[model samples]
Structure formats: structure tokens, C-alpha cells
Target chain A: MKLIDRARMKSPWVLHYNSGSCNGCDIEIFACMTPMYDLERFGIVNVGNPKHADVLLVTGPVTYRGARVLRNLYEQMPSPKAVVAVGTCACSGGVFRNCYNCIGGVDKVIPVDVYVPGCAAKPEAIIEGVLMAVERMSEHTPLKRGK
Target chain B: MAVKTILPFGPQHPVLPEPIQLRITLEDENIGQVLPALGYVHRGIEKAGENNDYPLNVFLVERICGICSATHGLAYCLAVERLLGIEPPPRANYLRVVWAELHRLHSHLLWWGLLADAFGFESLFMQIWRVREMVMDVLEKTAGNRVIISVNAIGGVRRDLSEEQISEMLHTLEECEKQLYALLPVMLNDYTVKKRTAGKGVLTSEQALRLGVVGPTLRASGVAQDLRMTGYAAYGELGFEPIVEQGGDCYARAVVRARECFQTIELVRRALQQLPDGDILTKPRGNPNGKAIVRVEAPRGELMYFVVGNGTKNLERMRVRTPTLANVPALLEMLPGAEFADIPVITLSIDPCISCTER
Candidate 1:
């Protein structure tokens, strides 16, 4: 009911991270920003800095070296944040399950709120994942600042 | 004088969405030395290829770089097919060309869009990607998926084009060609884009040749080398010619790709028009028992695949060489002595795909 919560529901800036993808899911995420899919219609904008973002859209199976960076990005975000794991690799390590470098799935490094499953998750499915993250954000109380 | 500083770019930079970190040392706003850090997106797909069955590796290699995935799939399939001593049907080879060229069309469009965004030309970025969706739609309609179509199989193609699909695809290409013509001129000749890209990352023909820069990077430097000219798959019959640019700068590289988009559309249209009538697939009988190597022209440049099989379903070894790997050293050579702010433009000029590199 507060002003911040109302604004949060109206718009959610999302951060996308490619821990160890083949770039399939990453390009689809990029497509969501383009004219055709246009995630802007839903008020979902892709941000670079983790601190200013509300929803973290993580793609790819977490690789050994990328794990540390992945953890760092997730921790930098403010409270009441949601992580959406995009693609089959990020969800459950689609084909790279046996690769020694990949620990497999975004959840291995961080808790995932929603999993959009595809080899390369389509823009439509990725939009659905962001919407799902927004819905979950409405359920939580916006964290009090300057605690 | 600006103070000397060490700046690490990416693994999470706004301009570069993919994972690649550039360690640039700056002296008074001019870059002194540059180093690239990798291993962020390494999935060890080469080893996975050795473990995965020969047929299944088609899908595995497709994941190497989603932008140019079909070329990866085609090269892998071609290598294994050679080892097995079976040729794909004639019609299948033509279909392979169709899909590969379509992938190139979309991949270059994506690169142009990203390059425009890198220099903060937001509307051009949006406009380029919008035209790109027409190619994506045709890919999805024919190959049954957008980015990684997976239409290619070991012996031949897994999908077939019906009468309606062929007609629809041609209509889409006509519209796409029209839209691409309207937008690409802005990227090629506009003063603002020229200021940002022209002469920004000039790699002389000698430097590009010595560095073994492949694809548009090489063509931009006025070298006439394209793997497609070597005539693998249906390219021999298609009579393909490489697009060449003499500038060897970021603008020249962009021009090569811009022209390549039109060439790709023509190749696809010709292949579809000359569509041979027959089965799209043929099954190989015996397991692969020798070593074979195949090189194909990916959207970025040359994509090579080496496979060794010992009369078994599992490959003894599978090695891949992506074009980005060939272009990086040349990129390192281009970085020093350039303005620090031009880093993103110069870095993207090579169209670096670290995932393909580390794999």
C-alpha cells in the first residue's frame, strides 16, 4: 500500500547475467528488449548494475569460475529481490550436465524464484518469467532502507 | 595529464552483455596495454563432444555460440559424415546451405544491432533488430526453432520445406530485404556512426593476414579468403563470392557484414529456387572409424571441426575452432594506442564470442 510498493509493481528493472551459457538464452533476453518482443511494454527494463535492479534474470549453468561472480552479483542487490533462471541449462543443466566446468543450474549458486525452460528460452517465455518474478515481488514487504 | 589507471571492463559491463573481461592500462586517456581474461563461460563442450554420442553431438555443438549455431552443426556433421564415408543427399546439401545462410543473416544483424548500441545509438539498435526478426521468423517456420534451429542431422537435414513454407519464406525475404535496405544505410554512411566507427580500429591488410583473421574481419582488410569459396557443402555449386572491403577499420568490417546480409538473402533464395527433389536425409551404416576435419564459413568467419572416431558411437575426440578465437589476438594488437572510450567499439568490431573461444 506504500508509494514504493505501488511503484515497484508498476515497473521492475531486471538484471541479466550469463554465468556459463552458449549465448542462446542471452540473445533471447536481448531480443526481449527489441521492437518485436518489447519487454518495455510490460515495464521490464534490463539494467547492468545489480544494485539498482529488482529482478535478477540469470541464464546458463553456473560454471566453476563464474560461480564467484554470480554470487557477488546476487549479494549486491537490495532485499526483496527475485531471481528468474532462464533456459534449460540454467534450470537444470540441459546438455552440459556432464561438463566438468559447469556445476549446473543457477540454483546451484543462488535460489531461483522461477525457471523458464528451453534450450534457448524464447523471448515470450522470458517475458513470462519476468512477470512471474514481479508477481512474487508483490507478495513481499519492500525492505526498509537505512536499517 | 590524466593519472595512470588500471580499469577492468566487463564480465558484467553494460555495452558487452556477454562474459569477457578486458584489463586495460590507461595513460592520459590513451590505452597503453590490454589483456583479456577468460574462463567465465567455458563449458568444456569439446570434451562433452567426446562423451556424447556422435548423433547427439549435433545438438551439443549447436550450443557453442547460439548466434552462429547452424554453421557449428553443419561442420560437425560434415566431419563425422566424412569419417563414415557416406554423403548426404543432394537435396539435403542445398537445405544445409539454406539454413546456414539464414543463420549468418540473423547473426550479422544481431552484431550490427549490438555495435550500434555500444556507441549509444539506441534507435538504430532497435531498428536493426526489428528487421532481424523477419529472418528469425523464417528460421522458426522452416527449421522449427529460432536461434538454434537444429535442422541439420548427421547424414542430412531433419526438416523438409513444403510448398506453402517455401512461398512464405520467399515472401518474408522480399520484405526483409526491403527493410534491411532502409536501415543499413544509416549504419554505413551516417556521420555520427562514421565518427564512432571509421578508422577506430584499423587493422591493416598485412596485420590481418599475419594474424590469421578470418571471416568479415579478413574481408574488411581487403583479403579475398572465405571458406565458402573452398566449396564445401553446396557452396561449390552455388558459386559464392566473398564480400571484400578495403578500409580494414570498424566501418569496413560493418560494411562487409552489411553487404553480406544481401548476399545471404540471395543465396537462400537461389537455393530454395533450385531445391532438388529427393529425400532430405540418408542414414550412415557403419560407425566412424577415422579422422576427418571440416571447415565452413560461419557468419563471423571460418568455423572448423575435427573429429576422430574408432568404430563406436562415442567419438574418440572432437575439437572445434571458432572464428572469435582466431580474431582475439588481432583484437589485442588493435587495442593499444587507441582512446580508452573507444574500447567497446573496437572490442565489438571483432565480434568476440568468448563462449566459443573458451569452449
Candidate 2:
């Protein structure tokens, strides 16, 4: 493993985006950051800017409008990026699957490296998903320099 | 002459957990006009509810807002009950109050933490959420889920609280109260918090009433109005009063919610003491054949569920008016004449739940 890859494994900055979810999963994500679940112990930081983020943590099924924004956020993140879809809604649209505005699941808009499924995914599950995404990040080949 | 600049905030921003776009027209640093663009989180759950059976709609409505899931489920059940001409057992009513108050306690703590984070108080945010986890544990032990506790059914609750669980809940509440009280000074009198919040976004009582604001936003502006006082579910049996503050600023809203957390804890204790022993569910004899309007006090404010039943398994229409929507206009009213830096703080003060608004 490269020195940079080892460093990245120790600390993975995350960017959270709520596509079109009920706030259940969103709050659970926040809970994961609290002292008890402390995703930060794994060297994770929730960054607001997409450019600075290494892992794109998305919650909720993609809504018609949210899909466009989700795609934009995913594209903005620098490569070696991993997307983790949190909650059942982001996995398979959950209950809002048949809703008119919902397009269903984060994968419908972008590739999700880790899928955490729960009505509102628990904090522990979210931490596990982030770890999985970091593993995916290590395996992913960095984008060609001049591409 | 001050230069005018348009600053776009959110759809995705650090201070907000949900997505909401604010197109702020600013003159120098002061906001001249603010236009909020929503629907970023719109899932059309109301439309989805129309196609589902009344029994199944409980889950649909509950997902409308995860923080206030219990109240949403209770409101839908109340509307459906009115349509079916049946009421849940008295014990169920008391149980609903217990869960609803627990929801309020956790939600207010969540908001308190977020508001602290908005002001850049990271340690306070962590401490508040640490205390909030106790309430979440209580909810999980009683309702079987943490955030979206699927406890409510169309007729009554799906599960009942055991004696051990109730005692454990009381002990936990005592711990929470101690922890919360310890932080009261930080929330109320911290110089940085007060400087950022007090007199920053002033919404006069008249302006609040005119804008049709509901919940703590309205109450903080000196309006003594809360749907909980109407005694929906088991509120009437309990001595309930609205928490009102006259400051009409971000600090007032914070104080209102802070005090409400203690109020809710007291309510849960009273509910447990008064809980009657009986069946939690009363099966509805037939499909709902009429239209009914049910309003319940969500953690945010008044949450109204209008169910139109056509004497079938499916509902004709299910309309939800969440408190966040009602408070938006009031938010627009509060924005102009405020500093641009204060926008996020004022926005969070309303506890803007865009998911609940757009849904």
C-alpha cells in the first residue's frame, strides 16, 4: 500500500447529502458522530465542501430534483472517492419507492460502494458502511493525472 | 451607497441537516430580501398515502418526519379513528402521551445541539447529543426502533410498555434531567450564544400571528398557542400548558425549546402515573367512510392530517400541513434587515425541517 493510501485509510473525510429522505437516517448519521458512536475515532470528519470530501455519504431515496444535485455532488468530489448509501430508502427507495417524485435509491443516480439498509440505519451500521467505503477507496485506482 | 450582492445558501450547507436553498439579496452585510427555494426533499408521501390502505398509511405518515414519527402516526390514527367512529382505549391514549413526550425531548435536544453547532460550539453540541442518546435508548427499548419508532397503529399502539420498562424510563429521565440542567447555563447565558441569538432575528408577536407561525417559533414570539393544549390523544387528561416567551428572537426560541424539554419530561412522568390498565387497541369495525381532520402537536408545532375516506381500503386523499411550512413565511419576515452571518442561526432557530415541509 502506498504511503498516501495508508494515510487516507487512517482519515477519511465524509460529505453528507440528503437526497430526498425522511430525516430519520439523517439524524442517525449525526448520532454516529456523537461521543457514543464517534465515527471520528476512525479519523472521519464531516466536511461541508464536496471538493474536500473523500467519501460521499448520502441518505434517502433520490427524488427527481435531488437526483440532479446528487450527481453534481458526486462528480465534484476528487477521484478515489467512494459513495456509501445509508438507509433502506437510499438502498431501495424504502416506503417512498412508489411515490411520484421519488426516483428510488442512491444507486439510480450514482454508484454506491457500500449500502447500509435500515428504515433509519442505526449509527453502528453507518460506521460499518463508512469503513467499507474506505476499503473501496483503497482498491480504487486513482484517476489518471492528465485524463 | 452599499453594494448589493446575492448570496445563495444551501440545498446543501453545513448548518442545515436537511436541504433548503435561500436566495439572499444583501446590501453590504445586511439582508435586503430573501427568497427560499424548497422541494429539494419532496417525496410526495401524501400522494403515496392515497393509494395505500388506511392501516398501511400509518407507516407512510410516520416517515414524513423521523424526529416526530410518533406524533405523525398518532395524528393519522386519530383521523382514521374519527372516520371509522372508534377510539383507542384510554390506556393507549396515556401511552401515546408517553411516547410523544419522549419524542419531543429527543427532538428538542437534537435541535439544541444543532443550534449550538450553528454558533460553532462543538463541545456543547457533543454534550447535548450525549444526553439525548439516553432518550433515544428509552425510545428504542419501548418502541423497538430509535429514530422512526413504529409504535402507532391505525387503532392503537403496536406494543405496550412493561412495568420494568416504565421504571427504567423514569430512571433514565432523571439522568437526562440532571445532565440537561447542567447545560442549561450554557444554552441560556453563554455570552457567545446570547450575542449570536438574542435580538438577532426579532419576530414580533403581531408579525408571528400575521405570518401564521406555529409551535415554538410562534410561542417564542409571545403567542400562547400550542395544539397540545387542545388535549389531543391523552393531553387533555394531563395538566398541559403552552411554553411561551416574549423575546421574539433566536434566544427566545432556544429558551422556549429548552424549557419545553423539562416540561415534556414532567408530562411523561404524569402520564406513567395516570396510565390505566386496559387494551391498547380497539379494532375498527369497517373501512373509514368519512372525511376527518386531526391536528396534533408535533415536536415542531401543529401537524394536521386530513384524511378523506371513501368507504374503501384506500383513502381518497391524505393532506399534511407541517409546522415548518407555516413558519417559512415567518422566516422570510425575520430575514430582511438581519446580517447575512445571522441567516443560518435564524433559519435553524425556526427548526426548519425541509423534508417535512415539502412532503
Candidate 3:
């Protein structure tokens, strides 16, 4: 119902973190930003800093070390935030579930709003996932300050 | 008097697609020393390979790095095949060449676009990646997926290219070549690209050899060694020479990759013409029992797989030495004397794939 919220829905700045993926999903995510898929046409920009991001796009199964970092990134983002897990690895650990150092998927560390499942999670799926996250952001209430 | 400051470059940075930390100690804008801290992206795939069956490990290895997934699978399968004392059929070998070279083209194009981005030439970056989509399209048409094709099996390729598909691929490649040729001058002779890259991050031939750098990094420094010369997976049948440059700078490395892209296109055409009629797989018999070392020329450089099988479903050990790991030392050598601004360009020159290194 707010004016800023309406504009935020139109342009969602996404922060990408590779929690320990094989780079398949990460590159596909990049492909989505390039001229071919041009996810930018929807006003989604891949930002490097967590503070400026509205959506957190995570790829790869969360490795032991990546879990803490992933949580920190989630905490850093301002609320009305949504997390989209982009690949089978990030969704449910995929083939790396049994790996000794893996902590399963991103959800193991943080709540996931949307799950995009594919071996590498094609660019189209990633675009759809981000759109879903933006929609989720619109419906959900932001956490109250000093709760 | 020089002021010293420490700059931490990544684990997450805009310039890097993967996570790897470089601690650069700067003395008044000149890098004094560099220390690299890794394992941020390590998923323990090597240890995981010990639990999976040999056939299943093929898929596991393919996930190590998406850009060079085919070569990773090829190296693992080659090692396993050697252990089992069997070879993939000739048709499979030729098909492997086709797919591997396609991987090379796509990987190089991806790297080229990234390198352009590193130097702040955004339009050039877009142009290179746009042409790269044709290669990805051909890959998707021939194989099911875009990245991580998963075409390689234990004994041979999981998929086969039909006559019509081969012709379509050739047509796509020709179109790709035309686009690439038009853009080649911009990458090779453009003012901005040249100024940023030329004479920056110079690695001498002796330094390259002493550092044991592999692939385009070493080739750019004037060493003409490419693992494809070893005749693995139909490279011998389709003969070609390594593309070498003497500058040993970022520009030289870019030129080597750009030239190799064209070379790989030609290789794909030749392999298709010489493709034989036969089975794609040989149905590898018996469990692997013994150690075998296999090497292949990946898009980055030489990729090595060391496998130890114990006549059981699971392998005893699987150690992968990726090209990025070898090139890291070369990166360390190139960094100290360089300016802070050129760090990303030099780093991207080696095409650092931390996932592949840490895996």
C-alpha cells in the first residue's frame, strides 16, 4: 500500500552468493543478467554489497564455512527481504548432500522464500524464482523494529 | 617513506564470480606482498568421490566446475577406463572431441567477456557474451543442458550427435565464427583494451616454467605446451598446434584464449568430418583395481585426475588437480610489483575458478 514499496516491487536489487557451488549455477545466474536473457529488463540488478540488496540469490550447497557467512549476509540485508535458493544444490543439497563438508542446502542456515530446482538451475528458472521472491516480498509484512 | 595497508580482496567481490580471499599488503599503491586464503567454496567432492560408485562419480566430477565440466568427466572416465583396461569406441572418441572443443569455445568466450568487463569495456563484454550464446545454444541442442552437459559416462559419452545435429552445429559454429571475427579486432587492437592489458602483469617465460603454470597462462608466456598434444580422446587424430604468445601480460593471455577459440572451432569441424560409425560406449567390464593417472586439456589448461580403485564400487581415492590451482602460484608471482588497480585484470587473466581449485 506504500509508494516506496510499490517502486521496490518494480526494481529488486539482488545480491548473489555462491555458498559453495560448482560454478554451474553461478554462471547461469550471470547469464540471466547478460544481453541474452536480460533479466535486467525487469529492473533486477546484481549488487555486490548486502546492505543495498532487496533479494538474496543463493547458489550451491552450503559448505561448512559458507553457512556462517550466508547467515551474516541474511542478517545484513534490511527487512522486507526475500531469499531465493537457485539450484538443486541450494534447494536440497542435490548431489552434494552426502559430501562430508556440506551442510546441505541454504535453508539449513536461513529461511528460503523460493526454491529454483535444476542441476544448474537454468537462467529462465532463476528469472522466475526472482520474480516469485519479489511477489512474496509484496504480500509479507516486514519484521517490527526492536522486537 | 611508504605507507603500508592491507586490502582484502574477496571471499565475495564484484570482480570475482567465486569466493577466494587474497590478502594484499600494499606499500603506497604498489602491492608489496600477497597471501591467498582458500577453502571458502570447498564442498569436499574428492572425499565424496570415495563413497560413490565409479559410474556415479562421473556426474560428481562434472559438477566440479561448470565451464570445464566435460573435461573433468573425461579425465575421470579416462582414468577409470585405463584402470579397467578398456577404451571407448572410436566414434565416442570423436564425439568427445566435438563436445570438448565446444566447451573450450564457450569457456573462452565466457572468459573473454569477463576480461572485457574487468577493463571497464562494458559494450565489448556484452558483444562477446552475445556471440557466446550461439555456442551455448549448440551445446543445448546437442546435449540436453546448457551448463554441466553431463554427457560423459564411465566408458564413453552418454549422448551421441546425429547427422542432422552435426550439420546444425556446423552451421551454428560458422555463424559464431563470423560474429567472433568481427569482434576480434576490438579485443585484439582496441585502444582501451590494449592500454589496460598491454605491459600489465608481465610474466616471463622462465617465470612461467619455474612456476609450473599450465594452459593459456603458460602459453601466453611463450611456452607451447598443451596436454592435447598427448593424443587423449581423438586429439592426435585431429592434429593442431598450441597457440602461443610471448608478451606474458594480460593482453597476451587474452590473445591466446581468443586465438584458441578459433582453433577449437576448426577442430570441431575436423572431428565431425572424421567421425566414424560405431558404438558410443564399450560397457566397461569389472571394477577398477589399481591406480591410474589421467590428464586432459581443459579450457583453462591441463586438468589431471588421479584415481585409485580397489575392485569395489567405490573408488579408494580421487584427487583432481585443476588448472586454477596451478595458476594461483603464477598469480602470486605476478602480483607483488603491480599497481592496486591492475589486480583484477591480472587475476582475471589467469581465469581463476576457485570452485575448481577448492573442490
Candidate 4:
């Protein structure tokens, strides 16, 4: 109960990275920012630099060429950061999953914390994903020095 | 020896909506050169032409690009119809004009939203989408698809606009126009937006013509070269001139779009005013040896489709010369001399659709 409470209270900052997507997911992410949804009210600001972020919001199916870039970006974020795969494309490669150019979902490369599923997932669904990530974060204890 | 660094600008860039990769050669943030790589989402529609009959190709071609799908089918059909030597019925022509103009309105609205997005003007982006939603509702209620309106067939349109629908659309246009009029001051006269866009990415008339730049980009450079001047569709019956600007910069290009939005509204109202009554389509008489090069004024600029039929079920060649591809060299030309900070705004001013270009 204390862990969950701590997770909720910390209120991680987000960094959205588009690996390779149609703007559908990106626009919906911004839609989450507007007055109706207002994720900012929870201290979830989309910071420009990944180093400052605690939650990595990834959109689009990571394409063959973009896989390396995504890995580098994921590594850049500070420790204890959670990766939330937004949209079906990022989670399961959606429509472009099996295409010659696509490298499948982000899970193929990184450990995703929560999956937000939608063709271009609605803003409400995105917020729910964030909440889920927060809940998941509460369950984990930091790794020991050698472990 | 120091190896040169190649930066991949997209497949996912902050500014562009569609996925396109620019393999950029950079000498410390100043781009030395740009090489575009495309076909990330090629669905092999051109090859699909062999399987689908000529009649069904209309619906098939419309799926090429979500935003300009209608225009794609329209350009293709106009080519094929011209080969058969048949003019559409008057009612069909007027309806085509009305729908085409409406598409121009929605497309420009969409572009406006995207431009705002690229420049980080979030509030304006939302407002543009809000207005665009109203336009989409009109399209959905009329043609039944929010994005791809499969209304244009070979001979004419598939359906007719009822008097009530026409009146409703006109009323909607008035409301949209009022909203747009309200937005004009904010977009054009605003201090920050103008500062970001004005006098940036200047393409002179000489440069525009030399680069074969068409549509609004050309008009923005002070050239009066609209394909509509050729009067292919119902544009001749419903009279309007191309909107041209003299600035030849990003501001001029935006002004061209803004003026054309008003022109499109006026064009739709005119089409509604004198819409004649007749059958919508005629049966396409198959012609195997027909060939045509059709040009139309897309929201971007001049779009040219060259199609040749080999007296068979499929086309010999279906080549498209998109406006963005033409403007790319111009974009590169403007990019080299300008400061690095202006890249996003300059790119946005051209209003590129990489899918259309790549396809």
C-alpha cells in the first residue's frame, strides 16, 4: 500500500518519442494534453529531453531502421524510467507489423511497462495507460547493487 | 580520418505528419545535403490495377493517399474519360466542382492544422481541427467517408447532391467561413506566427518557374499559374481566378492558402447557386488504346497524372508527378542558405505529403 502510494505521489514526467508512425498516435497524444483530458494536472509534462523523463511514451511500430535509434533514446533516459507503448502499432506493430520495412513492436527491443491499445488510441485510453504504468511502478523495488 | 555523420530526419520527425526519411549530411547543424528515401508504406496499388476492372479502379485509386484520395481518383478518371471522348453530364460536372472545392477547403484546413503543429502553435492546431471537423461532418453526411470519398467514377460521380443537402452544405460553408474569417486575423495578423513564418523560405517567381514549382507555391511567388486556369472540371462554368501573392516567402504561401480558402468557399456557393439537373454518370465505353496526361490543381499545387492503356484490362503505365517532389529541389535550395532554426517552418510552408510524393 505504501509502495503504490509512493508511486502515485512521485508523478513521473513523460517524454514522447515517435519511432516511425503515422501522425495519428502523435496527434492523439497532444489531444491528451488539451483541457478535456489535461494529463498535466497530474504533473505529467512532456519534456523535450529524455534524460529528464521518468516515463518514455513511445508511439508507432519501431521500424527496421528506427530500432537502433529507439534503443539509444531508451538508454538515454535516467534509471527508474518506465516505457509505455502507446497505440497498437507501438505495442504490437498494428497494421504495419508484418510489412517488409517494419521491425515489429517496441517490445521486440525494450521492456514495455504498459500497453495502450487503440488504432490511434484515444486520449482517455492514454491517460489510463499512464495510471497503469504508475501502478506498475509502485510494485517494483529498486535493484540491489550487484543484482 | 573523420567519418561523415548521416542524420535520419524522419520516418518519424516532429514536424512532418507522414513518414519520410531524409538522409541529411550535416556539418555541425547546418545541413550540407539531403537525400530523400521513400516507399515505407507502398501498398502496391499500381500493380493492383491489373486485377481490378476499370470501373472498380476508381475506388482503388482513391486509397492511394488518405488526404488527397478523391483528387487521385478524379485525376485518373478524368484521364480515362477523356480517352473515351465523353463529357460528364452537366449535373455531374457541377457536383464534381462542388465536391472538389469542398475537398480543397478541408485539405487546406488540415494543412493549416499541420502547419500550426509543426511550428509548435498548439492552440491554433486545435482550433483548425475543430473547424476541419465541421467540414468532415459535411463530407461524411454527403459522401459517406470521413477521408476517402469514393464518389468519382469514370464518367461522372456516383451520387447526386439533393437540394436539401446542397442547402445544408451551403449553410455549413457560411458558418465555416465565419469561423475562418475570425481565424484569419489570428493566423495572419498575429505577432508570433508572422515572426516565425514571414520573409522565410523565399522562392522568387524566377526560382519557382525554373524549379517547376506549381500550385500555391508558384502563386505565392507572384506567378498566375493555376491549372484551374485551363478549366478542366466545372471551374470554367463557375468562374474564379487563381489567387496569387507577390511576397514569394512563407508568408506569401500562407496568404495564397488563406485567399484560396475564401475562393473555394465562393466556388462552392457558386456551384450550388446554378447547379443544373441531370443523370450523374454514363457507362464507360472501354477503350484499350487510350492515353492521356491530365493536370489538376491539388491543394498542394499542380498534380499531373499520365496514364496509358494498352487495349488490355490493365494500364501500360500510371505515372504521377506530385507537387511535393517538384518543390523538394526548391526546398533544398532554400534550406542551404537559411539558418538552421528556420528548417521546420520553411519545410512546413511547402506543405509536403511524403506519402503522395513517395507513391
DockQ (model 4, Cα): 0.14
Candidate 1 has a TM-score of 0.98
Q: Give the least accurate 10-residue stretch of model 3 chain B, judged by summed lDDT.
A: B10-19
Which of candidates 1 and 4 is the stronger one according to DockQ? 1
Provide the RMSD of all predictions against the true structure, rounded to 1 decimal.
2.0, 2.0, 2.1, 5.4
Model 3: clashing residue pairs?
none
- lDDT tens digits by residue: candidate 2, B1-359: 99999988988898888889999998999999899898899998988999988899888888998988988999999999999999899998999899989999999999999999998999999999999999999998888899899888877888998899999999999999999999999889999999999998899999998889999999999999999889888899899989999999999999999999999999999999999999999988889888899888899999998989998899999999999999999889889999988988999999998888998
Candidate number that wins on lDDT, 1 or 4? 1
Better of 2 and 4 by lDDT: 2
Second chain TM-score per prediction? 0.98, 0.99, 0.99, 0.95
Model 2's DockQ score: 0.84
- Give the per-residue lDDT digits (tens) of candidate 4, residues B267-328: 99998899888799987876646689999888888888887787876777777787888888
Encode model 3's per-residue lDDT on B266-341: one tens digit a residue. 9999999999999999998889999999889999998999999999989999999999999999999999999999
Considering the two chains of model 3, state its CAPRI-style docking category. high
Docking quality band of candidate 1, CAPRI definitions = high
**Real interface contacts reproduced by model 2, as a fraction:** 0.83
Computed on alpha carbons, the lDDT of every model, listed in order, comes to 0.91, 0.92, 0.92, 0.77
Residue B75, candidate 1: how far off, in angstroms?
0.3
Task: Give candidate 4's TM-score.
Answer: 0.78
Interface Cα RMSD of candidate 3: 0.8
* Local lDDT at B258 for model 1: 93
Tens-digit lDDT track for model 2 on A1-147? 366766877899999999998899999999999998999999999999999999999999899998888999999998889999999999999999999999999988999899999988999999999999898777764522223
DockQ of 3: 0.82
